[model samples]
Target: MPPGTPFTVVYELDDECALELANKTVHGVCHLGWVPAADGDYELRMAVLVKPNGFLGRLYMAGIKPFRYGLVYPAMTRQWESRWRNRNRSGGARPR
Candidate 1:
């Protein structure tokens, strides 16, 4: 996505809610480790929980090659790192 592009989604805080993220562009589900930062924020459903080296990462590498040719692993790493830094700065909490 382009810079400053806003993403909108509905976050459900129910305990039954799966610890997973479904990327519409990649068309795959990623098993996100149980991180309950937000009780009800749509961005939770879109966070990059699984790295590109993981199972879904390989699939995205193979499938996304045809469209603009981009990989998810690098993106996932960048995303996770940035989020981690932000979280640390906000409240100085370590990743679990």
Candidate 2:
């Protein structure tokens, strides 16, 4: 998201949807997808498919994988949950 190409909607269907973007820096293609659980809660997942041009790209990804998984992703999930709660309190549209 940092000065990267805008995210484009990749797929939309009853069960799931995804948005993907290409970065200009160390990262390559990335996508975040959402699907509904059997219990009626939504589950989110992110995938980073690397097209590492050289050693640097690969190293960068490896170095950041821990931080990404441990910090960034969990924070993102919490933020999403908070937003959903706020929306529900304000009578926002039902989360699909």
Please list the Cα RMSD from the true structure of every candidate, rounded to 1 decimal place. Answer: 10.4, 4.5
Error of 1 at 51 (Å): 17
Candidate 2: Cα lDDT at 13: 42
Which tens-of-lDDT digit does each residue in 59-81 have in candidate 1? Answer: 76667665422555456545744
Candidate 1: which stretches are off by over 4 Å? 1-27, 32-70
Each prediction's TM-score versus the true structure: 0.33, 0.53
Worst lDDT run of 10 residues, candidate 2, spans: 12-21
The residue-by-residue lDDT of candidate 2 on 20-93, one tens digit each, is 65554443444454567799887665666656546777777788889988997688656644554465577765
lDDT of each: 0.42, 0.59
Return the top candidate by lDDT: 2
Q: What is the lDDT of residue 52 in candidate 2?
A: 56
